[model samples]
Target: MINLSIEEVLKYERGEVCNEEDCKQMTLERSQSNIFMAVVLRENNKLIGHIYFNQTVPFEFLTWEIGYIFNQRYYGNGYATEASRRVLQYGFEELKAHRIIAMCNPENASSWRLLERLLMRKEGQPIWHNANQYAILADEWQRNNE
Candidate 1:
């Protein structure tokens, strides 16, 4: 999952976006503490999107935040959905997550709809960015998947 670009690397490093490089050394350095995955098309081997999850809380609680973005040209083909499902599976099965959460603007119908498709329920309607928070528990995921 060391496919974070140089711009994302430098932006995260120096607090700004600069370049997009595929250099492995820089990728290894950046990928150690965080998880960032680039989604690519298997038929053509082209990068179309990315999804990531991380702990951003004082207490771990085995909870993680998942987010994703895909090229507009690649939309409507289920690429984002497939990538998100894989990440959610890994979080629940491998990482033993108690819960996984996602956030998106309420205005973005497609985004929240995708979250709904993943069986996440909307829990919060924050005014900040008019964001909607969605979450799914590990038990819920397991039952649904099974």
Candidate 2:
């Protein structure tokens, strides 16, 4: 529900926000999706990080692919993981998303680790994107109490 400035979004796009451009494109695509959100972190009102998702059909079933990024200065602080966990809860428990997935470059050990920490199963190998390919899918998320 946070308002992210276009400048802030662009900063992410240019890789100043995260070391990865896939992270930036995810933010841009989320802004376009309208169904998605880019939650930003602020300190003294300065934008510092973001988390977002998009609905995609990587399998026969509809699913939402979640993504996130935190400023390099903010790394090791658990911001990205915490935000991702909350967003996954929102997507599953509130939005009623049938499945949620996240893709990351195989070299992005931190991101892959985050997904694993969330208990998202590695669904498959790399898939193509913007002239590059990477690991895809986590799994369908099921809210136990539901």
Candidate 3:
């Protein structure tokens, strides 16, 4: 059990108490993989979120999944949408992915809307008690971008 103010908790979660050595080692390892990347503010270089695009099951298919999480304080500013759109573009153009998919709880309107804003097609409706799935094919992405 710990007693901490909301501000204190946010600072801790932001890595105020993190070990420099551990963070450096982690940066080295994570930097080796293009699958994950940090989203930083351009003005001050503050870490705001992370976005990843990685191969899925049966890797030969060249399918990938894109996902992201941003600081609550930074939502609705188009950061997530911009970062995620870039990630999806990388998967299609650089990774040569045949398909890129994303899933979000339909109840999360902002999240799903962001996905749609990326030009991903909704694969299914919200009727089922499951997360809404969306996807974009490489050709479709290219066509849209072109």
Candidate 4:
């Protein structure tokens, strides 16, 4: 199988690969949010992939949404999981978010499974993007980690 690389992911994010400028702009706009937080890794100080969180639309008061992307070369190495967990902890413990949610394309099995492994409950199909939503509450998170 062909692997997706971080360079590819970044190109997609920057609207260079996918021809979807909206996605690149959305990421840029969301990055400006005060509540945004990220978990990143590097080799010899060179940046790698990142898992990040930001306030979800219309629920920006307390709930948040998360997103992540890693180099396809890092697939199956647990790097995404490890970094995501740290960001989740930061979202709840540091940011005091009451809830955190994530959504992924339905066809992406690995993406959904990662949310499940993080103890997020499947909330069924979302209204847009043909993606599935998963969420976890702060109390639920605390209980699981405790």
Candidate 5:
């Protein structure tokens, strides 16, 4: 398991109350959720970003939902794409997940491109949330891999 400092958690929380106590509680809760994995990215020993995957039951579909955050300085560096690729490989090969899904704001064109490059299908029209939805099936991923 990866470890994160209280200070680092505070920074990532983005102004939320991420005190030591809260961090401990959150860490314990996260530990209990065996279906998720969180990874921290470091450069020059400095924490720069983090990503996570969680298994969810979305409607009739059982899927893995991915979410990530990066330090502002790390944007446009392709780290998101590489990290997401690694996660997808793990999800398919190791976790044996049948589906994976990701979503982003319609205005976030970069995310759309990354998803396309990974060969994930667009599915239906955007679902209203804080952002639009995109998804890929196990068959779609397998065909692309072949």
Candidate 6:
């Protein structure tokens, strides 16, 4: 996997690049906010990706939206699925979340399939970000796991 190009990684993921200061500020903001939490996905002690969860909106403590990205090289080895499953458990059990949701670019078939495989039901119409939304209730997660 490519190593150490912050601008390139940001451009690839967010369609924009940031300078070092902006990156540091963003990290600081996330760190200061108790509402957002992130977990790293690693393989053999190397970082492969990140999975993040945060309240869908401030004051909506029982609901969360999850987002993730992985290096292109690790795209099809089931790392996303494994990491997401564990994160979903953390959301429901540790965070006491009642619902967990996710969204992806409408054309991202792999992500849609991954969400479905995790048992999240597709919901609502597509939004302005051109993303399709999917969600799973805590009860649903529990029943399925049991």
Model 4 regions more than 4 Å off: 1-43, 59-61
lDDT of 6 at 36: 46
| Cα-based lDDT for every prediction | 0.77, 0.60, 0.74, 0.71, 0.67, 0.74
Expressed as tens digits, the lDDT of each residue in 77-98 for candidate 3 is 9999888888887778877899
lDDT of 1 at 34: 64
TM-scores for all predictions: 0.77, 0.61, 0.75, 0.73, 0.67, 0.75
Sorted by TM-score, highest first, which candidate order results? 1, 6, 3, 4, 5, 2
TM-score of candidate 6 to 2 decimals: 0.75
| Shift in Å, residue 108, candidate 6 | 0.7
lDDT of 1 at 103: 82
Model 5 worst lDDT run, 10 consecutive residues: 1-10
**Number of the top-ranking candidate, with TM-score as the measure:** 1
Tens digit of lDDT per residue, candidate 1, span 1-146? 23334343222122343234534554455446466776889999887766768865755689999987665667799988989999999999999999999987777788889999999999988875667899999999999999
Worst window of 10 by summed lDDT in candidate 2: 130-139
- Model 1 clashing residue pairs (backbone): 7-19, 11-16
Best by lDDT: 1
Whichever of 3 and 5 has more lDDT, that candidate is 3
Off by over 4 Å in 5: 1-45, 58-61, 127-130
Q: Tell me the deviation in Å of residue 1 in model 5.
A: 17
Q: Per-prediction count of colliding residue pairs?
A: 2, 1, 0, 3, 0, 0
lDDT of 4 by residue, 1-146 (tens): 01122245543242233334654564466457654433344555433455557777676668888888775767787877888888899889998999999877777788888999899999998685677889999999999999
lDDT value, residue 132 of candidate 5: 62
